[model samples]
Target: MNHQGWGAPPDDKGATPFAYPEQPVGGFPGAAPGVPFGSEPGMPQPWNVTDSFAFAWNRIKADPGTIIGTMLLGYFISNLPSTIARFIPSDEPSDETSLIVTIVLALLGGLFSTFMMGGMTLFTLNVARGSFYRLNDIFQGGPFFLSILGANLLIGLGVMFGTMLLIVPGIIIALGLCLTTLIIVDRRCGAIEALQQSWRLMNGHKLNVFLWWLMAAVVSLVGILACCIGTIVTAPLLQIAFAFVYLKISGQTTADSVGA
Candidate 1:
């Protein structure tokens, strides 16, 4: 599956014909292939953080409608379990019943969250690439859907189990695995492979990623303070920022063709 849009001809007789564009830092195609693409080694690229935030902001500015629509969808999906549980006739249910309900709701939320992440990643990639996208893009499921969902499930489970051991460890693991959804969408990798790949990319960059995430969290808290209406704007910004982060850390460009 050529998802990068490199325009390489299809393989014949089991040949793998696609090649990653040689993108070296400070220069286009002819620079040394192994050199880091856009910054000095060991020095964090300015765009790595700023560009993501900028792109996210751009999307929000350009298409407030789509941003709000997608975010509402996300909120609904995330809160579905609680919504359903509210109607269930549980007047002072026993501890066991409450535990079961909580577990079920958590599981449902996790599953929906994975699908939403995958779909949102695809939508952002499309928008970044200058392709026409619609609100429905947030729900499109393709061959890669299950793989992406599975990867998210594994990551969610890891976070949950890790939390059982210690809360801080779980948060760290969750952040470390943050890129798995994007990896699955971008690389067409299986669940385990996506998790492994995310782990690798995040290995030395955990602190940086955490800082960025914290920044986003702070911004989001401010938005929440504005009576939740700010989420319509903040959600899109965060998504686009995430798309930017996906591009930087994974060396992917939305300009690249999906399934190239």
Candidate 2:
């Protein structure tokens, strides 16, 4: 699509493509691409929770109205599964039908949720990069919808099975695999490779990933507490924080830069 300046009229060419910055050899900023995270000496910390929040807060303030609105849109789309479940036909006095319907709807919701989440994520990343995007640009992730659905399912099952063995392993697996969705989006990799790359790429940094996840959860809780109105703000903040982290880990940001 033809890129335009802010406030310019829309063109038929849709969302402006923002190419991911190239790293030297490794995918991260200072390290060789394909190397494990944090392997290169003097490389920037790939998982700085502090910088993530700092960047998120600043980006949100820069475009409070648009960011919050996009986040709300994502949040609404992600909840459609529950809405569908509510409409499923139930056999009188039999809860089995309802249970089955719930699972089916949840699965479908989850599939759609990935696409919607990816759209919002692309939106946030564009914002972080200081590029222009329409409010509707979030839907641009539609192309990778099925890939994410499969990858998400595999990761979920893997994590679920791991968790069944013991809670610790499950959390570790979850954190390690958490970046799979982003990988699929940015790298244009398939479901299996994305999952593998995420697990391996995060090697030696699972604890930090857990920490970031914990922080994100806390922020989400705080947002929910704010009259259930703060989520639109905090949710996107968390996603942008992750986006910034992704850039940092991928070496798009300098050691001295937060990549905001």
Candidate 3:
């Protein structure tokens, strides 16, 4: 009646159960499971301007498909309002009404940009962590998506309001808070948590972060110069690369950022 394999008995003295050790669930070895994966855990990764430039280059090479698609989509959407506004003619309304319409249109445009940015951030984080993600995953509506969009809008408004005070301060604030979207999207943090976390992680690396921001700005300028066509290819790439930079600087592995 013994069912044990040859050379072993089920209840023999000093016998150990035949069981395979569980594989690490979410992350790589030496890191906690059920978190996002890529960088070493528990240590804050530092990124400076140099890292930003390097990240940009890396992004261009890593996922060109996403980069190009996001860029093109952004360009087309951004220009649509302006094109429509042009056809409306300036003489159609009182000056105040026209101004209101213009402002509303601008707000709409800003919202569109925020949506695109949020989607791009998600995609970028996915790529950086070496996770498989589909384009539809970016657009799938969810609480996370709504949170990201709200956060982006708030941040964008802050930047705009700050700029009204002084251009330089606004630029600094914008850069300081640039990673908020990624933080929110990757960590599923609330609006305020993402903002605070971004500030905390960025404490010593502002200069380096600015450098990467500058590179992205430069690439963006190139897109502008190409009559917006260049963005069709660069937007998604830069976004994912930015995510990669966040991973490197934060030292967060894929599992740490994204749960299993």
Lowest lDDT sum, 10 consecutive residues, model 1, at 4-13
Query: What are the per-residue Cα lDDT tens digits for candidate 3 across 89-195?
Result: 57646777777878788778666655555555655565566555556444422324445666666778989999999998787778777777776555545566667
Leading candidate by TM-score? 2
Candidate 1 residues 109-176, lDDT tens each?
A: 76666656666676775565445567766664343456766665677789999999999999889878
* Top lDDT model: 2
lDDT of all predictions? 0.63, 0.66, 0.58
- Stretches off by above 4 angstroms in model 2 are 1-47, 87-91, 95-107, 254-260
Candidate 2 residue-wise lDDT, 69-143, digit = tens: 877877787888888788877767568878888999888887778778667766765565444544675676664
Error of 1 at 199 (Å): 2.0
**CA lDDT for candidate 1:** 0.63
lDDT of 3 at 67: 52
Query: TM-scores of the models, in the given order?
Result: 0.68, 0.73, 0.65
